[model samples]
Target: MASKRKTSALLAVGLVAGIVSPIAPLAVAQQLTTQSTAVTHTCELVKPWGLLGAKNQGTIVSPETVVVRYPATVAPGEVFTAYVQPGAAAMRTTDGRQAGLLSYDIAFPSNSTNLAANYNGGGSGYSIPGNGPALVDRVAANGQLATEGPFARISGGATAFHGANSRNGDAVDRWKAGMQVASNTTFRFPEVALKMRAPVSLANGSTITTALKAAGQSGDSDDPTRNTIQGAEEGGWGTERTNYYFCGSSANAGSLSTTTVNSSLPRYLAKTTTRMVTSDTLLPLAARTTNLTAEVSSTEELMSNIRPGGMNFTIRHKATGQLLATVPNVTVGANGQATASYTFPTLSNGSYRDEYEVTATYAGRVDDIESSTSEPVTVSVGYNEVNANVVLTSTNGALSGGTMPVTLRAAFALPAGKPAPAGLAIQLFRNDLPHGAPITIPTGTTTANYTFPTDTLTQAQETRTYRYRAEVVPVISGVDRFVGGSATPVAAIVVGSSPGSPLPEGGQGSVALEGFFRAPQLVWDWLTGSIGQAGAFSSGFAEN
Candidate 1:
């Protein structure tokens, strides 16, 4: 519990990059704010699960009008607050769950400003009206609190979790409420105030807005819920980059209700430039990695102390415009640069060997510094080379009439200390034609084991000669990052005939060809085997 308190405090003051932090502790920020703006917005709430225990999702159960007071004119490089008056009459859940911990999401009107989202804003919500003291839930008092996040953001701001607020999916958070909600006349969720900062310079009339959030929303895998609010999502994000909490205990998470306050301010614009560079232009999809860096500069504005804030690196296909991957919140250093190492995923539209572009969008701590996108850098992602060899372990030196064993080995020319390829698919071929569908190479002890079956021979003058090889093939719905390899085929010769006709009369010279010594033969129906011998060939004395 003590640890959670510390974390709550850290969130308000988390952003440590250039410019003054909008999410800073209120006492430190209020001193610099001298102006304020008020905006009224009407919000709608739709919940399907009512008292009837039925699911009527997307049905608007309540409509709310919220008044927000914000800093219309802010002191450049100073932090301020957007105060929201909380108002809700009756909020209940029919899912037999008393699990509703509420919070709100703040979206600024422009990229010229920034927002800071703290879970509880270092204070608990007022379940009752402001006349009451700060309300702490009795359930949460026992340590079973609702889940809130100090999740990282791409622009260095922080936010709480908002997603499939349901019982079906266990996301990174359980979205449990700290306690059951009860109301006499009206009730309010916690943390009605949101923090925001303005650029060092800006224009006037810039506005900010927020919305009431319940559980579940649009935009996640096409999800729609009663809590869905159009154009009012918590935007700044990272893949656990701004993560500030672990999951909390819960029975079944009740719908969370949130109200984020908003304010607006503007100043003159400053010109900013962003530049990007990568370590490599040609990267193999098998090992697609590069050190990507972006630098932001401003001639008139100061660009230093970008510490906690950073840029977002987006790698996408140039031709198809399919977004591949995004490396978010790369911290900008005091040197005005942010660096990160990124790997490319397989291209979906084209072959694995496709061209990609990397772009960096800067999100600085100071709003006046101006957010900019770096010029894209192009890189090629392709497959690595794979070489193959077929080793013939055949007793039939000539493809005249005997069984032969062989193994088709496909080897990848990887660097030293790199692990060899296994589980790669290959297809056997006879005379440049596929023998069958692709087959996977089994993972051998420290190597790949690729083996083939042998064909037996009969004493009937069966004459056949064929060249067999192996070629790399698709890995059955998997993205194969190895170039197709065609193995050098082995020439198999098998010639058999009736004993009298096959012996070639009058060949006086006898050769003890490949005959293992001291093994008694047992020949039945032309299939001969010694006492403890296999795959033995003899000419002088017909033996196996």
Candidate 2:
């Protein structure tokens, strides 16, 4: 990885006075009377060639910038003081060997700026030769120099050196230097201040913002804004160049400072709204016999906020809070809205409430702001009893085997305390008895008299008899109870060679006939438990 190194200098009063005494004791002492200088240096590793393994080469092509500043003033030759402190190496490997060379580009902006020729009196002090160049060997490593650049430019009041290097064979690059100036001219000493900017590698981009938007949020200018700029690998150099410029401002200058980062714009996704449109209640005399319907409406505002392909709609029973049904990801129109309907059947009669919720998920984040739920819709159903009456309308009940003309009429009356039945079911029995083999009756507006065939009886039998009876069973809405009330009176007929003849007589005939009539009463008693006495005809019959 690429890295950055910084060095700061803090000088003691004793060292400052010692370095400036040789120029002219009185002049240096006067210039250094009350002056303080602070120097800061920053080194940044850079790769202009974009070559791989360049970082591991142990030869760092870093541009070092320095900012020099003086907190106090001094008279010429009065021991103008400055100091340099060495910095740590810029790179380290697994083996703990420090690697790389330090190269620097120093710019003074004008030639008027000056440094002492031999501040240390040519002993252990840095020297700038008048003909050749200022060169200082590395003290920490072994082969590093203080000044390596040949690019020299004089402008304004300073001279600019384009590059420099240190040759420390110990694999560690350390820059160590310091200076105290004594001016030859009779002038006041100016304070020296240094400011530097280093470019560090930010290979991976940074995160800026995260947000949520409610459903139906339009493309209004109020929407959040987001914008980003690619980082630079190599740009302008020098101590004054800012790092990570934003809108032309150097608000972010330091390396890897999270506090300086902020969002450029906001992002919103998946906006939606839901509501209950209609609800109704039903009351049937039987449990699990009622049907209910609920209508719901949904609308979406933003298109891109919607998940790719579709969205999901679900209905839940609020009372039990159980999910009734789930409709998976449905595609919406460009208008960003859609509507659907649902019906529930065979629902048990009781108080029930249900709610509907819609969700939209996109790009790994569920946009909950756009999600919505409908108000609870409650439905109550009560027991509703209605009378179903079947009447044998025809007086001629005698018949032959093939296509006998028989008419059975049926009608219904609304229950005493309930509304009219929405619909009815009618069944016909074979032996004119209740609860026997059934024949389905078709629904109709008015009382229907259906004509069909009756079972054929053998002519060889001495006694041929047929009976017809009709029942009026009460059917209640939203309830499971089947009520039997005022049935049509039983009708009987005796079939013999003569149309009108006295009832045929035989031994034990009266006993056998009574047993046959009592059979139906026994069956009705077992089904309903209404019959009380053995051979009781009136007990099973409806009173009304």
Candidate 3:
């Protein structure tokens, strides 16, 4: 009981450390002798120094098996032995009598020798029997009975190592029994050699995946169990066979890697929509907002498995290459898409030349290493310039049959949030053509002064309601930005008056007639005065 408990503890420790060896069953013919047991032992296979480069561990796909080849140079006929001694249990004979003795077993397959000798060795191959209860049996008059036998010769090249020893006949068993000896015997045992077998199959349709571990450990693989020394098997009490053990480094096998490939199709399709809120209350220069929406999807599947919360959007100024805004951690809707909105900076009431672009990138999750970026979507920002009429006035008075003085006043319509225009230039036209070169003027710089005067008009040529017009263009920092506008045409009458016959009146009649005639001259003077003051003209004629 105590011995079994100790072995159980060791087994538990091995399992906890991930050092699991194959568990082979005892030979079917090897049974207890219904008597007392004796000293027990254990043994393990060791890789010889010559085969240090051999493969010890690996993994394979289903249907394929793991085949651990032995050192090619090793041959048959060389006896392999395991010396046994009293472990947790004291030595006892088959007759239930305590015996101060030890047990031993030897194996020597005839495959190498017999195959060369007769071109066949049957099923007699090498194998380490599975661990079990003490092999001690009823004590014969000659010695303790043996419980393990050697491989038997049949009619094949070599037999596959079986879970149990062969049971051809008692002759082979007797020979195997004779091979066992007491610890005091003079028989010599060869150096331990690694024991391996044919490819091991897992199941009918099963795959095997071995997770390689970080190396540099002493007992990572099926490391040999050593109680006996390496060279000549010097000082050791017993041996423990490592059943169904793999014997090499897994690092030398292979490696795991991954490659990333980009596709022409975007992981998410993005579209941007932009518009200005043109309300009476809102400033003409109010900032415009743009909404960006991206549809997340996978070309491999009908419906995209991509969800929300792992995506971000970047809005950039396409013209200036500036980053406008960044929207992160956006959630996708049930329709497999996400949306974000950003408003551009407020600008003056005028068309803008700048445009914005948006792009979305997906952050990958578990089991899926593929990530995608949406193609850039563009949104143009613009505004309508407020058109203003140019006003035409006179320096002296409305044009008449004599020389007339004229001045042109132009008002620029700047957007709400835009900077003031740098300057202004005006052109007066008698009839749409450059009115005798452009009149010198300053515009945009300030709100106070934005006007120019034309040269005093010379004597009229054919006076037929002389028409006048003006054009005003805004200058921004030496650049002509807004389109110029034309003022409404105005006409001046150049009529002639005939002298009235001498008044045939006397006394008050003559005086009243003189006052009435003087009224026209006064009215003409008043019209000129009103023109100079920028007052509206009631009618084209002089009034009382």
Candidate 4:
């Protein structure tokens, strides 16, 4: 009976590539060459029950079958013994009785290698002793036996379960009731593959779990009891299990339960959207002092159920809708996308408008959306033209020769309706002292007249007195031109010398020029022009 050639090779230690196939292998080598050699198998049903309960009674029952002898040359496309039921059957009885075969095997050896058998069964409740089936039926007499029959069938038909604690104490509900297999029949044993390795490669906040050990097979084995073998889990099985399931009790039966698995296997993970391409109305305008930028993008789908957490922005002012600022969360990586920036503050002259919106929240709602508004930014605040003044006329309270010249007149007030500043420049100062610089006033003039000269007079310059000042210029620009005050200080001017009619002890020619011309008037006209032609008409320049 050799039709079963099941060869599954998934050597995925890092998985490169693979494929292989060959079904029914000669109907299991002609059903082990025609059956019966003396079938006398007996062992009713021992039940002390314990796949999950009553081995010591913590309540975990389900795997309990005891027949002991049934493989004595049973041919017919022979591929002997392999049953792994349990997808729900009163969860396999516990209080309702039925729980006792934690292990089984009787001559079990038909993993097909081209039909051949020989065995005798020597026992004591059997624990191994040439096991069973083996009586020399070595093929090759007429050489024609390839019936091809069971190698793997049972498509689905073994529903028996119950595992929430019948006393195996939650090993993921006892490996989800032993890998819930509903079929099995294969020969040419020696084919087990399952691999997964990790050194470090799952970045972006990661998590991983892998544990599957059981390779090849032989005798004294260190721990190998899948009794029937099963594997395939990522999120759904028994009491919410995930992986691993094997059984062959007593030998300290343990190592092969491990649940809680998820390497991502459910499919369907789409749905995504993000925006803010560009449109705060193209934001810009305010004497052109700009720096307002905005950008946002998202689409989703990177695995691990579309994970992306971070992005929340809100800024408004579309015309008094007024929110103005709020940017929180913002992290978006794993290729989802995110970017934001805003700066626009110096626009205070005239005409302005704005509006913007962008939203993208995943796994919690608000998928992806964007908006923009802007256009109406006009500004201009500027105008300057200043003029100031202070001027006076009339001065001289008492000055007996030393210095004099204090005249003044200045005025300006342009910059209200403009007009009144044509080539203007009038700045004068003396007793009001602002000395040196500004005294132009000449183009059709706005009135600018000033004078001052000095030379050290005594008597405190006849008791002191003088004043004058003026300034204008700053039209329509940055602004800063001033001057106004001081133009009324006039007093000080008196000089005398008369009285001299008897200088006669040493007198000569008539002397009647009072005080002798006070020694001034160029010394009395230089002593009357040297006294020569002054004989007849000169009676000492009298009377006036």
Candidate 5:
């Protein structure tokens, strides 16, 4: 009983430091012969799961099988999920003694790129000869219980080196089985799975290998892995097999192949600069062409020389959040500069000012660079310019059928060679509200004229002056855009010579009227004065 107690004590002490070479001291080779009645043997059987097969069967486990599998090629910053598996166990005892899987230790390659981010242990498939049931056994890693329907999760997902072993920096598993093995003449062990994760760095070629340690330590005898199995080999002894089957000597034969990081896969950095080439908001019917300039460059050398048609520009309506167009395949020049343009449709909403937000994307070359998109930018589409004068064909300030003719001229600041538009129309407003029928600008002409009858103008009891403004309306099939001061109030008709309230919405998305929350006292300021002081409405209105 004293000798039996000593052997059991030593066994526990050895396996704790991670499975290694010669965990127990041979000097005290367990004087078991004097204490136990069971017979013993020095010969051993190498589990058939190993590659040596029958060649190593009769000998004390001389060949080991530790295999590794994972993706051989990985880019920088990619997470590598790798698997390390030790050989299955095949042990036998003529006297009805049992021995099988419990725990083992594994190590990762020592490299700067390998990180200890994730370590998971699990597996399935096993056959219990004594119990006659197909069972599943696995190492529970990172504080998880094994799914074997037992409490076998000893201590896995552990990274402590435990000792002076160079590979311990990534040690995982000091795990144990939940149930003791049942007596059997021969028992089959279960397959195990250990997974680890690390990110690849900026290396041209990095080697990722996982190695398994062995129990057959010391150069004194090859049969050391044998240990005269007196039933104590069932993990009763400190020197235990991962499967308690005398897991032979280990070799570094199974390791992952080299992983290569491509040059353009995840290497180069990129930037895209945007500039509004047209300078200001386009005037309605003023050649709906909105021009833009893009500077697309990369941090890598000679990237500016990339061929044309690699960039795309996306334009979206700010008011309605609708996709207008994607100008595809523009080319960047030697200076990392490119150009893009979009012809906008008429703004559909008359009350809201419309702007086109643009974003540029660089479709990098598959063989050399990666793709990227630029920050977004916006430019107002249209805010028309109107100059008006009133002409009366009847008595002045006439309330009856007197004809009031107003000549409307269309003009805009367009690029050279770009013609001022035709096919556009203007709508008149009587004091902030839409008033008359829309007038169209005939093709081949830049001017539109409309005369209104007197009865259309309504009056209140007090002597009042009616403020009138003509706004360019969307008559084309596409976008109709605008900004604050819907249309400058050009003329006023006096009924009794009394003026009304100050117009706050004159420069809508342009500025802050001049002071206090509402449109400032200078509500009638021209477009310049209108824009600078009213940044308050930029989100909904603005002028070039």
Candidate 6:
């Protein structure tokens, strides 16, 4: 009795972690912020033998009471507990990033008789007499315990144990960490009852289970209230028994009840827009810009689950179905919108006719299911005007019979490897004014050709000069295509000298010298003025 009093003072506690390495305590409190769903159930064992009498037949065996508690929000370094009355197996928790192992801490008061010490092989059981509290660091195999310091080994031992025989293997399932009896009056327990923390990478909504049970049980029950305790359960304990020679027919415990307080489900929609953007005044080889924007919102306005880094978009060329770009990190604004901008390579001179599209997808957090892709937005790319050059050259430098031959060359200036411009018209200008009706020219494989009629310019009785050049007329609007260009202006002079007029110098002649040279000199001066005007006109046109 004296040794038995000392054994009553000690208690046992336990816990577990699945990983080979132990979990470290967290420095800061990292809560999940979401409400945790509770999982609870009950179990019981009874006897059917009426010879044992009512009190012994229907004994409320196993754990008389059981309660498992979980933190509202589990985080790194946080702790939870489970309460078992007298007998049971083990408890479990939902598996998540924050949940890894089950750490059990049991305290046995000194001189307390709540615990029973049983020896191996159904030997006589005894209680320790008055003695100071003693803690045994042990590893359990089957229902037997061996002394080993706490936290000395990785936690992956069996959770249910038989009192004397090694009832491991299939007997104990679905649980980790268990204990065995060392002596009739003493117990070997884990030095530290701690469940290693889970890896931080585990996502929200992950679940884990913790359970408790006795090592073995008899096949027969004496309780009239229930018979299945010792019998097999479909989809449950199966044919496994929970009975040991020292502790015969250990009973199963009661279950836990929980009512859901709220419901959590995420739903939203996403959309995007793509457009070709250009300057108001288009230029040749201008860069093309495609602006993409995405918007996301929950179908129910009451809930808002969009996070900052929860959206993305993709751009593609429609004609070739080629992917142009993908933007993965789009920050969602308070208004539930995100945007991306991309500039295409500069385009060469030609009729650009291509299409592009953009699509968006939401990258939600845990519990927030990813949203479907947004509707594709399409835009077209093409030129509104033609890019070509026109040049005018005189066939003859001098004018006779009040006529001069001039040629107009219209050539499309396009980037290398590009097809020539088609369907072009040219308008010639002389002396800074329209010289004649617009002339339509047929396009060659490369250049368009046109000829100015002879006598197109008439010289006065004296000598004069004429300035000529061709230009592209404005015909296209509300669209962008080829860029417009012009050629350098050229000039021709006509010197008028009658056959009757005699040239004289240093000596007298039939005609006066001054009168003879005066007309031609004046004509020459007028020609110079026309040349100047042509230059000024070309520069001014280019500026506009």
lDDT of 1 by residue, 1-544 (tens): 0000001111122233454333323222322121222222223322222223322221111333333444433434444554443334233433322223333232333323333443343323223223343332211111222222211111011112333221222232222222223322234333444554544544343333333332222223122222222211100121111111112211111211111222231232344678885667777666667788888876434444344557899988788898878989888877778889877766556565678889998875564445789889987877433334323222332222334333333343323333335765567676578765666654332235455444333333432334556665533222224434533344332333333322222222122322112112212211432111234323213222
Candidate 3 regions off by >4 Å?
1-304, 307-390, 394-401, 411-413, 420-424, 436-446, 458-462, 474-480, 484-487, 496-544
The TM-score that candidate 4 achieves is: 0.18
How do the residues 1-544 of candidate 4 rate in per-residue lDDT, one tens digit apiece?
0111222221111111241111122222211111111111111111222243222211121232221212222211112322111111112222222211122222112222222122222212111113332111121111112122111211011101111111222234332321131112111111111111111122222322211111122112122222222221112222332222232222211111111112221111123454433333333332222222233332222222223445555555544556656555655554544455645444345523223333333332221112222232321212221444444333332222433332333444333343334445555554466655765444334344454332232332111222234444332222212223433322222121222322212222222344334435323433443211222212223222
Overall lDDT per candidate, in order of appearance: 0.39, 0.27, 0.31, 0.27, 0.36, 0.34
Candidate 3 structure quality by residue, lDDT tens digits, 249-362: 123111111111112111212112222221221222244664566766642221223463356787787867899788887776665567666576654345443456777876
lDDT of 5: 0.36
In Å, residue 368's CA in model 6 sits off its true spot by 15
Query: Ten-residue segment with the worst summed lDDT in candidate 5?
Result: 162-171
Tell me the lDDT of model 3 at 540: 29
Candidate 4 wrong stretches, greater than 4 Å: 1-86, 94-271, 275-300, 303-331, 334-339, 351-353, 357-544
lDDT at position 118, candidate 1: 36
lDDT string for model 5 (386-480, tens) is: 32222212122333332222222323222233222565555556557876576554543433345443423343323233445555554333233
Alpha-carbon error at 440 in model 1, in Å?
A: 6.5
Candidate with top lDDT is 1
Scored by lDDT, model 2 comes in at 0.27
- Candidate 4, position 488, lDDT: 35
Candidates 2 and 5 compared: the better one by lDDT is: 5
Cα-based lDDT at residue 459, candidate 3: 38
Q: 215 in model 1: Cα distance from truth in Å?
A: 62
